[model samples]
Target: MSEQTFEATRAFIATASAEQVELIAAALRSRRLALRPAPADTTATSTSSLMKIARLGDSVQIARIQPQYLSGLTGTVINTRVTRVDIELDAKSTRKLARAKQTRFEVPAGATSFVIHGVHLNSLDIL
Candidate 1:
């Protein structure tokens, strides 16, 4: 992500409402519970080809990119798409989001969602 987009995302999370955060947390938990380990297949060509899939509610640590103020932050995966993952950050990460910028704007009171793209998949380590 670019510096500008990262800043915007951080701002959004920082100003999110408590209810929103709770909802995201719940979703993550639900997803985590639903995950099932893939069955082993003798027909499979390569074991290494079997990717480590990240389901919802999985605990994850994201690597920080320099020039972005926040260092690596841990969070729960709330949602997933073809190319992006939505995460509900933990309290410490949320605080970092709040402090990412000097100026603040009024954000509607609700849930805060953050996205990390597939290109940065290497930065995401599932716990």
Candidate 2:
């Protein structure tokens, strides 16, 4: 994506309604897909092997875009998609701050899993 588009997306996400964000997250999660950058050779075989490497239950470090959220948070991969990843969040820190009533970006209550979109792939780093 172009820099302009990327920034626009970030802005949109930042102001997106809770319902809208949840809807997008739900759709992405349902796919159970993961994305890998295409190889240098366009005709090369797909990166099924690489995807498998970050399989379910694998530990991963996901970069955070919103300060209200945690950055470099370690979580277990619960699902993957060609353009997104689903992770079961580690709440060791969040649990303590759950009482905060600040109106900021946050994981939904009772939601253990969250989806990271392909556009934000750079924000995800597999450990």
Candidate 3:
């Protein structure tokens, strides 16, 4: 980290209120999932693996999603592109997300679908 940036961060923390500090801390906790670069050693996904998980109508579990609380929710694949999947979350899952994100985030009316990147989905377990 650069000295100027380091100093600025320190100065902000030095004067920030407890709530502000906590919010910053929470961001730090989720930074890895927000942007964790792959190492050079890792290889790209194979075609077969993609087929298994990227097929339309497959059931999938949400993982490493932003807002973090959305992780573990289950949904069904409604559409699939090259690297993104449009999922229609179950009614129960929609209700759970709505309640959890009501204050911190906007929950649009009749919002039950989400487009998730293939990489962010931890599992595409067939049901």
TM-score for each candidate, following the candidate numbering = 0.43, 0.39, 0.45
- Per residue, candidate 2 scores C-alpha lDDT tens digits across 14-106 of 998754575456545533443545667688665533222344566777665555354656667666544455666566534523445555536
Q: Can you list the residue pairs that collide in candidate 1?
A: 20-111, 28-57
Report the C-alpha displacement of residue 18, candidate 1, in angstroms: 28
Give the TM-score comparing model 3 with the true structure, all chains together: 0.45
Q: Between prediction 2 and prediction 3, which has the larger lDDT?
A: 3
lDDT by residue (1-127, candidate 1, tens digit) is 9999989967987887754555455455556644644466556544322223456688887764443553476788877643246677776666666556634322223425443333243456788
Tens-place lDDT digits, model 3, residues 9-96? 9999999975556545545545544465656686964321222334567777776566577677778877654335667778777767
The reply for model 3, stretches above 4 Å from the true place, is 1-52, 102-127
After superposing candidate 2 on the true structure, give the runs of residues whose Cα lies further than 4 Å from its correct spot: 1-53, 96-119
Error of 1 at 22 (Å): 25
Question: What's the true lDDT of residue 37 in model 1?
Answer: 46
lDDT of 2 at 29: 53
The true-versus-predicted C-alpha distance at residue 7 of model 2, in Å, is 42
- Name the candidate, 1 or 3, with the larger TM-score value: 3
Displacement of residue 88 (Cα, Å) in model 3 is 0.2
lDDT (C-alpha) at residue 123 in model 3: 41
